[model samples]
Target: MRTPAAALTGVVALAFADASIVALALPAIYGRFDTTIVGVSWVLTGYAVAVAVAAVTLIAVRRWLPTGPLTMGGLALFAAGSTWCGVAGSLGGLLAGRVVQGIGAAALLSGALELLSAHVGRERGRRLWSGAATAGLAVGPALGGALTEAFDWRVIFIAQVPVALLALVVLALSRAPALEPESGEPTTNPLWATAGYVSLFAGLVGALFLGVLLLVEIWRFSPLAAACVMMALPAGTIAAGRLTATAAPAVRVVGGTLALCAGLVGLALLPSASLAWAAAALFLCGAGSGVVARVLSPAAVPTSAPLVRSGGAVVAAKHAGLVLGLVVIAPLLAGSLTSGAEQAVVTGTGVLLDARMPVQEKLSLALSVRDTFAEAPRGAVPDLAAAVDTTNRSEATTAVVKEVDHRLSAVLTRAFRPAFLAAAALALLTVLAAFAVRKTPIGYPRWRAAPTAILAVLVLAGPALVAAEVAGGALDHGRYQETDPCAAPADPYPGDGVDALVQRVAYGALHGAACELGLSRERFLLALAGQPGFAGVEWDPSTVERTVRAAADRALDDVQQRGDLPGWTITLVRAAVRSMPLEELLRVVGLR
Candidate 1:
């Protein structure tokens, strides 16, 4: 009995570990596949969705499948899926492999629990299962990080193959009993259990998903460093386990939910990318999750039902929550990040245009800075200093650029706060759901009344906190106003020809228009270079600047000759010079 229990525990640990082991590796996967965050999120989502679907199906047919064969078959499938994931060449292929892994994981989870219940009774089995899963959750991120850093993300999955095989061997040698259905009415309510499970996982999405992204993408930590930081979550869980072991289910649920909510709120209010702040938040999350699991697991699936069915239901609910959380949060996060980047570019460009420098030098500096911003990887904060040409720039100019860099970094950091707030909102919902868990019969009404009042306070307090922060200007939503560079006093030029006028306007208007359009100068130029009649045009800095000046010259010449050109003619010319290549502008003016 002991040997079989130990073996099954190992299998359970692996299955749970796989759920989050890949989180720290997500950025690496995104880079490797050249995929969007939403696309890359499908890696985690696909696995979770597969697990939920398969677990449900397995539960429906629990009475027909024998525990021994089910466990062995799951191990085989898990091994195969791991192999496929390790060798997958594309995002689509990797997603397919993850689904296979999810299916196998569901089977193993349900079957192992069923076998344990048959061998040692439901009470002992639940304790062992929870402990094993907690152990896996604790180690997954760190192990995944070490493997991803030392080798590659693929190794994380590949390493799972041997562990699955060993579990299979152990199961075979133990001769575990077949699953059997229970006869009595279930003590726990399935609806309450499902709700609790879903809310628990949904709240965790912020810590596991957004936290990892912030560490790896925005903060620019190596995968190993991110993993090391994430270890706080599991460590908290382990510490809370002993403390919550004898607590009433209701007390544990509420306490855990409160801790998780506090953690998420802390993340939302993060002043900077300080590891100390993140660690404190993650510890709360981990500890809360541990307590929730300890109190909620047995209740999640009624002991009156077949052990396999009950276990399947619980697993399905939890993974489904993960899928749901990602689906909702990923889009919000992506949109916030896009808006933040645009804001940064606009703000940074304004700083450059207003800087005290020679016009020609400013133009050169702007081009260099734009190029630097363009070179930064997606979802990463641009390094402003790296974008400047220090060799030719004055100390004053460099100092200005450094200030712009600081502002850009601040904007980027502020962007992710909304996502964290959204996560905190989700955690608050978990707290509400946890209040629905059945209380002990001894003080049922009195216990329920106090928590009900507390739940209301939490519900109101969460949004209030978010609102206060936003109202305090933690999230800036100001729009960029396009400046009219051609307005008012005209600059005195040595030459009165069309070329000189065009040069003045082009230099004056380009930065303002680009800011209005939320584009870096480099991006705006490259876009123009790609327009009609500009095919095969060289995009070197000098070439792009010359082309813009020439295009402005042609547009001005055309409007002047027409004499009756509308008041908006100059506006059209400016737009053309900003968007169209010089050749395209000449063709539009009938001068090609």
Candidate 2:
């Protein structure tokens, strides 16, 4: 006899997989939609929001509805959404389809979890789904990356249709017993409960959004490397999930929530700290998020009629968190930059919030000082000398330059810290909300929601956080270069194919470029080589020389095309300068 139990597991796994599949498709989505940084996030936010609502409302939705029809209906909606997304010509249409898909995802997600919880013993079920969801979560990104690399992004959704249909066939073939629906009003009314879940979700999502953006944008990280670091969230969640049964339920929920808050605080406050410390904090926060998801699972369920409603609520709460993370946090972080501006404005309206400003800039004189510094390099004189002329002060430009640089640094630091502190406060608030996740009854059947929720929190958050940074230009759009090894070779020369030769010629050029541009060549190269196309490609002389020259050319064309330095990446500029010269550098950097 075909069993219903394994089918439920497959369904939940698929749901978890779908949630992550979008992460790798983000760059492609942006290419088609051409949406702004904040706007593009809604593609994710829309899906999450719809899913969150569906999870909470599905209990009532499925009350009169049979599982067969319910599953089919959801699958149909999902298929329709997938089709819409696949062929969407505009951002709006894509977003709408994403929302539809999210709704379908929520239905499938919660429905499958409910069925599994009812059919299997709770603890065993929780462990099984927990492991399955975690596996799916982990696999989603890798799958998405591979699919995105191998085929058009539309194929991802199109491919899902068969899976959904297969799931339906399994359901039709199985003779699963229908559980009696819980009859009575829920402890938490559906509407208010959903709102609360949405609110909490928003805070968590916001914390992630702000944390990651600050890490990469303000701090600067490469996309692939940032993604690697963000994996700490899933790692933390897994660790927390493992500890949940061991710890007192109340303690796990409360402590996890508190950790979640602390993570946000660390993310906001500890940007300048070592990457390990920051990642650790993110892991803790993710663990707390997992704890919160697990804790809420039982409450969102009832051991009676309308069972699906409870399961739906749990899923809704989980996805709501995701929606809030992306949509709310991104704008808040962007707004924080304005907060710095507001502070400057409060000091005096004359000050501007120029993202293009050099790292050194006082509120009062940042522009003039930055101008002086830039001009200094052009004049072959000390920046301080140039500052005098720009400031029109009697003191030597060098002296004024030092004073300005010092003052500018102080102002920028002050302005930036407040935003970080604010982000920390929001994280702390999220931690508090996590505590609101009620502890499960002692020996209560382990809810599938717990682990699935935790997995979602960890894995989904990792990609979202990374995406937030990429969209914000924190990590440069996958660009890098090497230094020239030859003694001022007039032409970019070829090199031998030995590892040391490649290192000496190409890596050396990268290092030189980094030094000249005052950037970390090692870090930048490390970042670039980390991308999918470049990963493990190796540092060969021919490859390095070609790549270095290409990168330099790309950098100059980038500057000219975009009318600005690409991510202010000096290494790319230097590589271009070494490969060609001032005119070529300008032409390449300015390539439109």
Candidate 3:
């Protein structure tokens, strides 16, 4: 009996988790369908809109639905929806299935609320229901990411079928909850409370939706890595569960909203692409979301009204917020990414032109980079590594490749700033919306806020200070400022690894070459990229080519004058100087 009860509970949790499970899958879906961010976002928006509509419609029919039959029926529908989604051949087909899934989700939530209340007491049942929903929301993205990384995005839908079926079987065999006639008005979903929900859920889109996109798409992290990084969000939420358990409901709502805003702001103005930094920001978001949801869910359910109808109102309000957030976020993100793509190309070009390699190599790199970005799908991190393949390159070229890749990643991070800020602005509105809950349910169970509330606020604020530089960035044009590569001297010979040895050998020759060219090592390196033909200045291939030939002639003369430089190193430099379609020159400086 307990096992059957547990299975039913798990089913309820699964239904709620389905709401945002696809966040991690969006990139895969977007790439697979070759759709725009706005287009793929419908994948989430469809579910939210359908669920909101279902929850609202279910409220009208709540009276006649029997708990046992409803639960079983909902599970069956859910299973069918999962099957449909799993087999979908097109985006439209996936959306059709999501609608079915949403309807099934509402039915299950309603049935589970009544059944659990009958099994336990009403208060415990409601608590269990709310807790499961938030837990599911918290865990959904990470779980989806793991599954997507391990398998295909389709598997997330396919996997749900068996769980739903098993729960349906257990439910069919279990004792039914007795439904009694209730005497009360069908509660009007409170306007103020609904508005608050709208704001809270809308704000959450920043943490759950945009946060994942930034991690996977912009940061170029694997879905699994992004999932692990985002665990901070759920962890914060779960931690806040106990921390805010006893605080005043109003404080939890308002304070939680503020924390979410701070986290979003941090995300918008991220200090770096480091996973640890992003996790710190998400932690505040998770904690705040958890605190608010727990307090808001039960508080929204009126005691005098039927539980299912009242619960439906809460679901409707929450999903309504999601739908609203998506509607706005989708378009804004699409435009931001579009503009960022251009900036990325410009930034990438500038980095290559300024590289410490041969002018001829710079010319070649420009072409490779242009082709790579052109071939890449919209919103993808173009594989810059491919643009500068180092498999067989000279050690000097390989070091340059690493620097180029790292520099591009840093520049790309800025491209996502505008979208993240938009999300933060949405979250900031939650503070105002939270105040609409003028009266929290009296005597309702609280997650004891205790001293943790103070600590949570302080922790959330910590990221804001670190991220203060975002304001400066937003005010400036997307033109990234890179330091003078020549300003810094080379490091000590790196570790004893193979790549390290290669760099050591390469730098030794580079130092010799710089001296041969009668220039500082940095100036020698910077000269090629600074050529007018390669730089943003008007093209002057004649002068740039002459400059390269002159540098090569001077280098050879100096080596002969010194009689100490390696002949092979000069041979490599001479080949690069003439590389532009004396195609045979490539063999001289070929990869090891």
Q: What is the overall TM-score of model 2 with all chains considered together?
A: 0.55
Per-candidate TM-score against the hidden true structure: 0.75, 0.55, 0.76
What does the lDDT read for residue 67 in candidate 2? 62
Q: Higher TM-score: candidate 1 or 3?
A: 3
Per-candidate Cα lDDT values, in order, are: 0.72, 0.52, 0.70
lDDT measured at residue 592 in model 2 versus the true structure, 0 to 100: 18
List, residue by residue over 429-526, the lDDT tens digit for candidate 3.
66654554445464455345554456466445745545554643533424565333233234324354454444444444445544444554444444
The sequence of per-residue lDDT tens digits that candidate 1 reaches over residues 497-587 is 5655544455434543344334544345444535222234455656645644644554454444444246587677667566876677557
Best by TM-score: 3
Q: What RMSD does model 3 have? A: 8.9
Whose lDDT is greatest here? 1
List the candidate 2 regions with Cα displacement exceeding 4 Å: 1-4, 16-28, 55-57, 121-159, 178-200, 207-225, 272-278, 302-305, 337-592
Write model 2 residue lDDT over 1-592, tens digit each, in one string: 1366676677666666665666656555655665654776676678877887776677665667766567667777887888888888888988889889988877776666556655675444544554555446444544555566567777777777777777777777766565534444333333332334444444455334444443334333433445566677777766776656444444554555556655665554442324675676667666766665555444344343244555566566657556655654556544545544323222221122212222223223544643453554221212332344444332433344444333332232233344434444444443343333344443454445555455445435544554454454433221122222223232222333343232233333444443433334433443343522224445555654555554454434433443333455755555547757444543543431
RMSD of 1: 8.2
Model 1, TM vs. native? 0.75
Task: Rank candidates, lDDT, best first.
Answer: 1, 3, 2
